[model samples]
Target chain A: MNLIEKYAAEVGKYLPSRNRADIEAEIRSTLEDMLEERAQAPNADREALTLQLLKEYGAPRKVAESYGAVQYLIGPRLYPIFEMVLKIVAAVLLGVGLLGFGVNAVRMDMAGPALVHALGKLFVDSFGGVMMAFGNIVLVFAVLERVLPLSDQKDLTDEWEPADLAKEQDPDRVKTSDLIAEIVFTVIFLALFNLYSQYVGIVIFNDNQWTFIPVLTEAFFRYMPWINLLWTLQIGLHVWLLRKGMWDVPTRLINLAFKLGSIGLAYAMLIGPAIIKVNTESLAGTSLAEVARELSPLSQFILVPFLIAMIIAPVVEIVQTVIYLVRRRSSVPFPVK
Target chain B: MENDELIQNMVFELRRGIISIAVLSLLGKEEYGYSLLKALSDQGLEVDQSTLYPLLRRLESQGLLQSDWRIVDEARPRRYYVISPQGREVLAQLKKEWASMTESMQKLLS
Candidate 1:
């Protein structure tokens, strides 16, 4: 009711329901005692002064935060790691969510009228849970990492000697050899998965036997049967890391390369044939007519970047990998064990 | 190791297990939140209430500590915590382990 009581209620609001009333009473008494002490001293407006004191101590949230250490899924000491995890989680969630929606729409549209309702139900039923489960697991792991941190940490509140605080930290870099193997494995897997799924969907569903063995499709799937080797390689790489008890600069660099390669492969799958068709048409016809006709109206704008993503983007990944590995490794201790 | 590193390591090591034991031992006698913290700190353990409170909540949630709020102070109600039967069993096992560890470490030091 009064200023002290108001502050008491505010603090109580943040506390657990069971403890609220008692904490509120305690806070009220404590504030009243403080106000009485303040009143004994000279103050212009005693009542207003009490209110000012309460405000300075801060609102309920600040008071509660002070009482409890500011905890996150990742604490302040490991915030960079937390932030990275958050970014990866958000990206993965967004990517998966979009993929689910795309798959749902495509599968729904593709189904015949007889199976339309059934297919729609089946697709939603199967994938909706998968997407939600993945998000939940990501959230759980993020929280776990925050709560049970894996990194070496120093209490932020500890006073530090400048020499100790400023001492150079030698960071471990991701191993390049490990990364190369991972990337090679990942890219091959991605390329193969793309070719296989496309082959299966385009060929088997095309409802034609002869078209299934089309020279283009054969060349594509044939060139990349080891695509699933991505899975084997990734498992192997992780096993190796687990065994070695560390993954530093070189591995991260390779991972970046692999990611770039995947994006590149995706781009190639999207539009590589179009470019080939265009070039072949021009060569055969001795003119741009056939090429121009066959190329979609917006094809060049789309496919040029697609090609760049396929070729140049992987190169960018290599650069990013180098930069990331160099900076992070400089501070990290090696052999994470 | 030097004195500071040794102390630091000891503090960190104590931190890993002490909270569990302290909570168990505190609850072993009787269960009350602020009083328990005061008692521990009074005994020179000096644990922050911030850490103690959350640890209490976590232990309760994990079924190691059972708690219920009672209107004991008349003016202010408070939650009381008690070691569950299972918690007592765990505490006994932990005590045995601690004793053995201390014995071994002392022997090695000697």
Candidate 2:
């Protein structure tokens, strides 16, 4: 149509479909009113003035944005399941990558720099594969986003209370040994941290004698009461889980609490201060000197960040705990007399 | 420049809060979009076209304003907006609120 009509149509492109036609007509009407008023002024050229009026009004996209048309591709209703599926896909990709890497390494019969070169190349080649996998997932979710109607939100949403996970025959039964093992482990860990924290440091046999460097900061000790409370409650939770012989709501909740506490404590230690110390000078003339330089002082007194793998263990454990908590509740049936 | 921007934003917010009341008060007499803009401007309440049209549509959607597309004086069709019964009741309450608010504000400012 005309220039003003074209501008209105352009603005209509970004408006929500329900309001698009009505808004476009209103915009065209307003623009004509503006043009008529401006063109009546002295030295007014209708074509030049219409162009300036549209320019002053702003770009089509921006004018449309001012109306606040928010459309989420994958809304909150599907986001949780999307995240779980994404995590599963990532883990599968990592597993496949490792398998391929192992097979390639075995077949090549390469060593030293050649193996390192192959490993580096493997990572570089992985970028394309990861992008493709990620793209496919997003496409699937985008389709699902539009296909799922608003009426089905209640049926699909996680508003319902989490159900009890146990089967009728043995739903409430706790694997007794798991709790016992955890209790023993936590107790020994508490003893090591609380009773003998000073011995928990880097000891080097230098000058034909052992020298221990104390490295736990004040921040680390300040966290001790909270840490002690968490571990003690952890032991108590295990004991209660055993005595009860099943996970009740309260038991699971307490476990989640202590689990959160441990997470908070670990996160604080990770970000706050060096909870453990190592002396590079002490490790001089030793192979560990380079490693000591690589390792940041861990804030975990009990976690014993000797291996980085152990630090990650707590995170993996908490994730599984959350899944377990979401899946199961105490659903024991009363017996008939 | 920054202070000017800040004051402009604050003024915008102030107008946004009260523009509804002003529109409802004036819409006792039916006015189309351009004519309503003119009426508001004539009363020294210069509202943006973008802001006013959307507001008219929204207020209509909310059942506070009634509108219909009609041509007058053999001219082009325009959506004429008038206050709904609900809008009159809301405006009556809002006038009392505005009076009370201005009284307190005057006391604070003085």
Best by DockQ: 2
Error of 1 at A319 (Å): 35
- Taking chain A by itself, what TM-score does each prediction score? 0.31, 0.42
Off by over 4 Å in 1: A1-337, B1-9, B12-16
Give the Cα-based TM-score of candidate 1 against the true structure. Answer: 0.34
At residue A194, candidate 2 shows an lDDT of 78
What interface root-mean-square deviation (Å) does model 1 yield?
5.6
lDDT (Cα, tens digit) per residue for candidate 2, span A218-302: 6678888997888887876765665566676567567667766666777777776566656567667776576455443432443
Pairs of residues at least 3 apart in sequence or in different chains that clash in candidate 2: A165-A329
- Residues B2-108 of candidate 1 have per-residue lDDT tens digits of 99999987997788577778779878767566677667877788765446666776787788898876676463445678999989898999899889999999999
Which CAPRI tier for candidate 1?
incorrect
Among the numbered candidates, top TM-score falls to 2
Query: Per-prediction DockQ, in order?
Result: 0.06, 0.36
Each model's lDDT comes to 0.56, 0.72
Residue-wise C-alpha lDDT for candidate 2, range B40-78, written one tens digit per residue = 999999898878887888899899999987878886677
